[model samples]
Target chain A: MHEMGIAQQLVQIAIDSIPRDIENPKVEKLNLRIGRLASVVEHSLTFCFEIITKDTPLENARLDIDVVPVTVHCKSCDNGWEVTGPVFKCPFCEDGDVEMLTGREIEITSLELADELKI
Target chain B: MEINIQKKVLEANDTEADINRTFFKDQNVFVLNMMSSPGSGKTQILCKTLAKLMPHVRVGVIVGDICTTNDADRLKVTGAKVTQINTDQFGGDCHLAANLIIESAKQLGCEDLDLLIVENIGNLVCPAEFDIGEDARAVVLSVTEGEDKPLKYPLMFRVADVAILNKIDLLPYLDFDAKLVVDNMKQVHPHLPVFEFSAKTEEGLEPWLDWLKIKVFEKTGK
Candidate 1:
């Protein structure tokens, strides 16, 4: 699935962003903010991440993910509400023209690396 | 040491994409990144398009798929220079990233080409997120896939410069509301170009081909 590709990209990003001073810093944790509308399977991403990070700096890293819900702003009613399900219609005006404010994000927010700089 | 790396994962890909954009500009080539779901008839449309434009323009293709060279083989029959990249050999990639595309384009000798059509792996969501330095992005949607596709996959619709509703010939057999699909797409990307055409019977392809020619000529001054 696409999750595997995204996982690979995340690992690459982590590897590339490592500070030069940290001599093979052991990655402890990786946090990602994924949205429901991104159509990514979080379990699949985690599974793929584990496989992709093997023997790398992130081998033992814990993958943390936050599932973000889609929020829509109704243009007609000027109302803001969370998309309560797969249905994207506005609750107030029953309008589908609501603009999407959030969701559709697939970002790696932060990484926790072993403090090799102190040693 | 917990170092904070607030970097976008796709930054590397974007850097490669910038290189591709500059390369295309220098060569005066118009590139189109075609995206769609599996079984959306992307290759078929390419076949028809190549047939129509072969006489008027020089066209080349770089086809990406998870496995198999089936689409490339099909396009080769159209007498266009074609290159195939089976991303499975790399990592079973669902979408073609900019670095991979640039590598493939170089292998295909795209510098001499006027237009490069990149048939991205047939997955709507992932491919829409990646920018491959194409002059235009075309999202192909067939009538059998239902009308709510635009609403369900808004990112693809919103990112695409053109939405080609393929397989209009099957409209009589299927209960697909073409108008509803257009309306939904317009809601997301107002003023987006929508084209209804059938690759099988060669119906409604003239306007699309014409628009494509105009775009290529405008971009390349050819």
Candidate 2:
């Protein structure tokens, strides 16, 4: 699954983003912001995470995912709304010329680490 | 202590992709990433496209598959420099990542070519998720696949800048509504450019080739 590649990246980013001063850091939670348009299966990503993070700094890390919905802003009418279904027209002005505001993100917002460190 | 580090999960990939993009920009090579199902006639269409694009535009190809250089072999007939990346060695990746593209481009020598087309691994879902440093993304949907194919896998068409409906020569034999398929794709991506072609009969290729030429010119200014 491609999620395996993404999961590997997530774990790598988590480890890389962590401060080096945190001695013998133990990961407790991983906060992820995944948009609806990313097409990543949450369960599949979590499963891959479990395997890839086995011996890494992210081992046993609890994943907290926040799914972001597809939101669009109408360029012509200056209206914005969340897309509920396949329809992409602006709700207020019914304009089809719209720009996607969000919903394609796959970001790691934060990492929670245990306070009990070796230092 | 909880660390409030906000960063993109695929930042590493994005960085590599940006570097590749700059490399292409400096080299003046327009890269197209083509995605589709296993038997969607992607190689055949590329053969036809290369036949038309070559002699005027120097074209190169990097094809990704789970195993074998079969597609690369087929594309060799067009005389374009073809590089085959067998993902089986690397755990059989379903899509070509940016790092892989960078490696392949180095091998293919992108500096000498005007256009470098990446024939991605034949899968709709996986390839859509990864950006392989391509200037444009094209997804081939054959008539044999079904009109509702876009409905089932919206992300592929949603991300595609262009959608090519191949195998139109068999349209007279099959009970497929081409209009509905186009409509379905438009539903997902309102402004997405859709091209219909029959690689067997060589019909409806001019627009596609012209579009590619325009893209190449836009990138290379040559």
Candidate 3:
């Protein structure tokens, strides 16, 4: 599945961003903001992430996923509406030609590392 | 310390893709990244395309698939230089990345080629996100997949410069509305050129071939 590839990329990104001073920074959590239309299955991504990070520094990292819904702006009625389902039409004007404002993102928003001072 | 790194995760891959863009530019090669779902007749289109253009243009193909070289075998019948990249060994990658394309280019013998078509693994979503340093990305949609595919996979339709509605030969049997697909694609990408054709019967393939000719001439001036 493509989720495995994405998971591997996420893990690599986190590992690459670690500070050199920290010997082995234990990843506490990974914050991801994935949009609803990104075609990424959240459950599949989480499952793959766990398997990929088993022996790595992010062994016990928690995945914090925020699923963003598709928001569309209708040019006909000048109204914006959140698309809840697979259909991407404006609720106000019933326009199929509405512009998609969001819901195509797939990014690692932030990373939470264990505080070395507390350790 | 929580580091808020807003950097793109695929920056490394993008850098490599830039190298590929420069390489293609230097070679005066027009590369096209072809993407579609499984059994959408991508190889069939390539075969028909090569049959028409091989007499005048130098064409090469780098086929990406999960396992077999079945597509490559089909392309070989067209007498075009074809190379297959089995991505199954690398965990069944859904798309071919720029690094993989670069590696395939080496084995493809790029010096003797003018046009290189990369038939990406039969997946719509993931392949559209990855830029493989191609001049244009063409999305193939067969009539059997239903008319709502453009709306369902809008990102792929939006990213593509050209949309080929293939398998028109089967349109009479199916209740698929071709106009719906065209409308949906136009909604996502207002000016994307859509070519309706069947690679099997060679129906409505002339315009697509002509478009390819114009594209090659525009890029290489030959």
Candidate 4:
């Protein structure tokens, strides 16, 4: 339900973060780090990104996404594991008191540009 | 050749949520963000819950909708401060961000209240990804919906602190299996407590309130 709006945000944020001191900045790629636990579909985001970036500075920008997998730490046992599915329980200790380590990030890591560009 | 921005896509929203978290802590208010799909009986459950929760704890609610204050109007009669936020004016988004919640809560004077509940815009996907500076998150699933919803939307189930299996009253008339849903919910997040109850019948509502009371006390330390 939100790929379109989030893509719009991605486009705006990407364009705003570009260096303005250069003459005719041209963006080539937008790198994104998304968590597996995050509710974002890579295909949907790519589709939305292409549509919103049309005619904008990011029109030719390729979306490079890195899917971060879910990892958790068991507080009771001090055990950590890379979770493959939806289960968050501590497999070693059966403790439910677990904290997520890496699976909730939703951020723009960097931008590859041919030259300096304006959004 | 490249610029390292390392910025969050929802930086504005995250900053606002951080500000809201600080304000909620300063105000000593325990906040809960409740989410569900449309027609999950979220309002009906809230009405029943407020009726029982208001007498003991000072509660406030912010109801969000696409165009109307219908949910807020229903919640106001419980004597708890209630406010309605229509997302239509704010780009008509499918989710309620913290920037909107803090404004509505402050208008309700939530600083004086012991508990603040935000009935998030009825959505499973977008709302799950957005944090509204809440101490706890709850997801409501009715018997009318698919049992595999937890598997389909693992992010929502994974993020929720608790799950509510609503509409047990309709189980006899439908093919939905409550146990399977509970199992599916646990498969996604084993730690979350699931409450099975029918808001219409007022059955199984007490346990949820008890859980809420404990959460409020744990956070407010009162």
Candidate 5:
């Protein structure tokens, strides 16, 4: 699946971000923010990450994905609301002309490392 | 030390996609990324569409599949240059990436081409997630696939510039409601241009062909 490709990218990003001066740095956890509409299955991504990072520096890195809810802004009502499920119409005015405000991001927010670089 | 690395994991892919976009621009080639589930008649639609445009424009194709040159072989009959990317070599990726497109374009020879179409691997969910550096993304939805697909796969419908409701000729024999499907797609993306047609009967391809020809002309000024 394409999750493998995404997992490979995530693993590469984590490994590349490690400090060069730090010796034998280990990634502890990775904080990932994925929007609800990103179409990524978390378990599949985690499984792929685990398998792909086996021989790499991110072997021990635990992927923590935070799923953001889909949000839409109603132009007629000038209000925005988070969609709980497949409801796309504006909750207040029942407007179908609402614009999507969020829920499409797939990014890494931060990462935790075992050893801190000394100042 | 909590070194803040607020970077996107897929940044590398995005950067590669931008480079491909620039190349398409410089070459004056309009790239259309066609995405759909398996058996949605994407290849048939391309065959019919390319046959109509080949006399006017130079079209090249880069088709991706897990392990088949079947699509390429079929599309070759249209007299367009076709290159196949078997993802089986790359661990059977379900979707085409920008890097893969770049390599396949080189294989297909993008020079002197007015339009390039990347037929993405058949899938509704995974292919929607990747941006493969296309000037326009079109989602092909068949009548038999159910009208609720747009709701279930919101991301795919939302990101598409146009959607083709294929197999319009089958509507007479089946209980599928074209209006309901169009309404459902509107719920996801109210402004998404949808063209309802059947590639088999060539029932409603004029609007799609005209739109595409105009787009190619807009890009190449030819």
Candidate 6:
């Protein structure tokens, strides 16, 4: 799965983000925002993260996932709604010409250092 | 301590994709990313496309697969410059990322090419997730596949500029509803163009060929 690749990239970013002054920094948690349409499975990603971070500074880090909902706006009728299903048409206007406003994010929003960035 | 990163996990891929896009733009090369499920006749349609476009258009191909070069080998028979990327090192990468596209393009040398077609590794889910700096994205859905594939894999259809319903000749023999599949795709992605054709029989492929030729001419003036 591509989660392994994401995990590898995440670990690399986390390790590189450690403070230069800190002797040793441990990441306690990785805050991630994954859209509903994103191809990542939460548990699969965490599993890969654990294995990849085993010998790295993020060994103890756990992923905190936020599943973002798909949101779209109707370009014709200007109707907007949060899409919960596969169909993306506007409920009011039934127009398929809608613009997506959100729900495609796969980002690392923040990271929690092990209590004040201490060793 | 909290460190705010606010970075895309695949930022590296995105960055590379932008670079690839710029290169294609500067080189005036039209790139198409073809994605679909396995056995959907992507390779078949591509073979037909190359047969039709070669000599008229200097087409280059970058074919992706896990370990085999079978698709690439078939495509090379058309006299187009073809390069294959075997993703065995990445544990059989399910999709082709932007960096891999650029690597293949460089290997083939992007100059003197009017169009570059990327045969993304089959699998509707993963390939749609990765953007390979293409001018157009086409998803080929065979009628033999379940009619509910559009609903099941919305991302793949939603991101596609065009949908190719391959194997239209088999429609009479099978219970597959071309109308219903088109409707389903419309539901997932509004205004997405669907070209129903059989790559095997070469029926109804002209419109798709015209679309590709138009895109290439629009970009490369070829």
**Which candidate, 2 or 3, would have the higher DockQ against the true structure?**
2
* Poorest 10 consecutive residues by lDDT, candidate 6 chain B: B213-222
What are the candidates' individual DockQ scores? 0.35, 0.67, 0.39, 0.67, 0.62, 0.81
Off by over 4 Å in 5: A74-78, A87-98, A115-119
Q: What number of clashing residue pairs does each candidate have, in the order they appear?
A: 2, 0, 0, 2, 0, 1
Give per-residue lDDT, candidate 2, residue A39.
73
What's the TM-score of each model vs. the native?
0.83, 0.94, 0.88, 0.91, 0.93, 0.97
Candidate models: Cα lDDT each: 0.85, 0.88, 0.86, 0.88, 0.87, 0.90
Worst 10 residues of 3 chain A by lDDT: A88-97
Candidate 5 has an lDDT of 0.87
Instruction: Write the number of the candidate with greater DockQ, choosing between 1 and 6.
Output: 6
* Model 3 Cα interface RMS deviation (Å): 3.4
Q: Model 2, residue A53: displacement in angstroms?
A: 2.3
Listing candidates in order, what is each one's chain A TM-score? 0.91, 0.89, 0.88, 0.91, 0.89, 0.91
- Residue B70, candidate 5: Cα error in Å is 1.2
Rank by lDDT, descending?
A: 6, 2, 4, 5, 3, 1
Interface RMSD of each: 4.0, 1.8, 3.4, 1.7, 1.9, 1.1
* Candidate 3 lDDT over residue span B128-178, tens digit each: 878889999999999999788887888798778899999999988999999
lDDT of each residue in A23-62, candidate 5, tens digit only: 8777889998998888778888989888988877678788
Query: Per-residue lDDT of B40-87 in model 1, one digit per residue for the tens?
Result: 999999999999899578899999998889999999999999999898
Deviation of model 3 at B87, angstroms: 0.9
* Model 5 lDDT per residue over B148-194, tens place: 99989888888888999999999989999899999998878877889
* RMSD (Å) per prediction: 3.9, 1.9, 3.2, 2.6, 2.3, 1.4
Better of 1 and 4 by TM-score: 4
Worst 10 residues of 1 chain A by lDDT: A84-93
Q: On residues B1-222, what C-alpha lDDT tens digit does candidate 4 reach at each position?
A: 888989888878889999999999999999999999999999999899989987789999999899998999999888889999998987788999889988887888976799998999888889988888899999999999999999888889988999999999999999898999998888777777999999999988899999999999999986
Q: Which residue pairs in candidate 3 have backbone atoms (N, alpha carbon, C) closer than 3 angstroms, thus clashing?
A: none
Error of 3 at A22 (Å): 2.5
Model 4 quality (TM-score): 0.91
Comparison by TM-score, 1 against 5, better one: 5
- Candidate with top TM-score is 6
Against the correct fold, how does model 3 do in TM-score? 0.88
Local error of candidate 4 at residue B152 (angstroms): 1.2
Model 6 ranges with Cα > 4 A deviation: A116-119
